[model samples]
Target: MESFKSILSAKGPSLFLLPTWMEQNEYLTAGFTSRNGGVSEEPWASLNVGLHVGDQDADVVRNRQLIAEAIDWPFEAWTCGEQVHGSDVFAVTEVERGMGRLSRASAIADTDALITNVPGVLLASFYADCVPLYFYDPEHQAVALAHAGWKGTVQQIAIRTIEAMEKQYGSKPEQIRCAIGPSIDDCCYEVDGFVIDKLQPLVQELANLVNSVPESMLTLVENGKAMVNLKQINRHIMLKAGILPIHIELSEWCTGCSSDQFFSHRKEGGKTGRMASWIGIRER
Candidate 1:
C-alpha cells in the first residue's frame, strides 16, 4: 500500500476533494468528502446532499451539482445504494442506475457496501453516524466503499468488503489500502451495559483480539458497556485479514465532534441530514 493524501478544496461552504490518488494503470482513484459547501440552507445549512434529511429536493440536486463541479466533473455521475448496515455490496455498472435515491429509493433498504471498477462511476455511501470505510487495490485497479455502524462493524463488514475485492479482483488484503472515513468517534460515542455484555465475550475469545476496550469499564466477568473505539475495530479487522497496519488511514476528524463541519445522527438525531463518502475511477 502506497501513501496517498486526499486534498481538500472549499467551494462556497461545501468542501470537495482534489484529483490525487495512488492507483493501477487501468485507473483506480478515490476520495472522501467533507461537509462544507452546497445548496441547502438553515438546518441542512449550505451544502446538504442528503435528501432524506427533509431538505428541499431542488436544494439537494443543486448541492450535488456544486460538489460535482468542485471535483471538476461536467456533471456528477454517481452510483448509490440502499445501505442496510448489512454485508451486501453492489457492483456498480452501466446496467443499473436507479438503486439508491432517497426520492425513488432510500439509503435504508439493504446493502451497506459498494464495490466498483467502472470509470466515471462514483460509488457514494450515505451516513451521519455510521462509519464509511473505503478500499483500494492498486494491484487489481479495484475499489470498494462500506457504511458500517455498530451492527455493521459487529458483522465485520470491512472484512467482507475485502473478501469481495479478493473474489472480484484477486486483490490481496496485504496489497489493499483501507481508509476509515470520519464517523462518530469514541469520544462522542456511548454505549450501555447490554452492548458491552454482548461484545466483551466475543472479542475476548477472538484469536486476534490484540486489545480490548469495552463501551464501559465493566469487567469481562461482569457486563459493562465500554466505549468501543470503532476506528480501531475497523483497523483490527483489516489487520486480521493480513492488511498491513500502516496501510490503514483513520480520519482523525469525528463527525459528532466536528458536527460543525459534518453531520451527526447522534448529535442531530432523526432531523439531521447525512454526509456522503464516495470513491470513483476514470475508465477512459
Candidate 2:
C-alpha cells in the first residue's frame, strides 16, 4: 500500500499525508503539499511554496500561509532553509522558528536539511521533482526534512540527516521513522554520462553495503545514459545507516508523471511552482 495518502479539500491546500504517523501521535503533522489550492500566477500557477522561484514574494508567502492554515499549524511555526542542494542539516531551535516562512533572507543559510526537537516549529523544504526526505525520532520528539536533488543525493543527504539527528538529538537510526516523499522516478528521470558517472560509485558502495545489486539502482540506456531510482537509493542509504527496512515509507506518486497534481521541473521545462514537504511536532 502507498504510504502517502492524498487528502483533497474543497478549500485549502491538497496534501499527501503520512496517516500512520498522524494516527500514532496526534501532535505530529507531516505531509507533502500538492500544486493545488493557493494564490500564485502562471508558471507558479497555484500553491508555490518557494520564495526564490521567481514567483512574487507576496504570492508565495500567501500560498505558504494557506498551507499552514490547512495543516492547522500556525504560520509562525513554519520554518525553512535556504536549500542550497547540499548535505548540510541545520538544527532548528525555537529562535529559528518562522525564519524562512516569508522571505529567503530570513531562512537558514546554505542548508538542504532541517531537524528539530523543538515542539511547534514546523520544518519545511521546497521541491519540484527532487526527492523530499522526512525523518522522525519519536523517542526524542524530533523531526527532520531534507531536500535531495541529484547533487544532494550524490552527497548522501539522507545519511547526513540521520547522522545529524543522532548527533543532535540522540536519535538512533533504529528508532527513527523515515519517509521518502513524491519525486521524479526512474521512469521519467534520465541522466547522461556526467550524472551516471558520478552516481555509479555511490550506487556501487551502497549495493556492496546492503548486499544488493548495483543494477537495481541504476539501469543503462543508449548513448551512455541511465535511469536512476533516487528513492530506492535513498532508502538503501537509510537502511545502511541503521534504519530498518520496515520503518521507511516510500511514496509512489511520481511528479514527472502526475503533472496535474505536482509541478515537475523536468517535465515543465524548469519553469514551475514548487511543492513543500513539512514535518513538525505540535505543542500541547
Give the candidate number with the greatest TM-score. Answer: 2
Query: Which digits, one per residue and each the tens of the lDDT, describe model 1 over residues 1-284?
Result: 21324444454535423233433343444555556666677787766777767889888867766655665654436667766668876766665433444353643257788887666776777878788888888767778899888778778888889998888779999998888877787777777777765655545543235454433322333234456667767777777778897778777777889876787878886667677776777667
Clashes of each: 15, 0
RMSD of each: 3.8, 0.8
Model 2 regions more than 4 Å off: none
lDDT of the candidates, in the order given: 0.68, 0.93
Candidate 1 Cα errors over 4 Å, as ranges: 1-13, 16-29, 74-76, 97-102, 106-109, 205-224
**Model 2, global lDDT:** 0.93
Residue 187's lDDT in candidate 1? 77
Q: Candidate 1's error at 152, in angstroms?
A: 0.4
The alpha-carbon lDDT assigned to residue 119 of candidate 1 equals 64
Error of 2 at 14 (Å): 0.9
For candidate 2, the per-residue lDDT at 184 reads 94
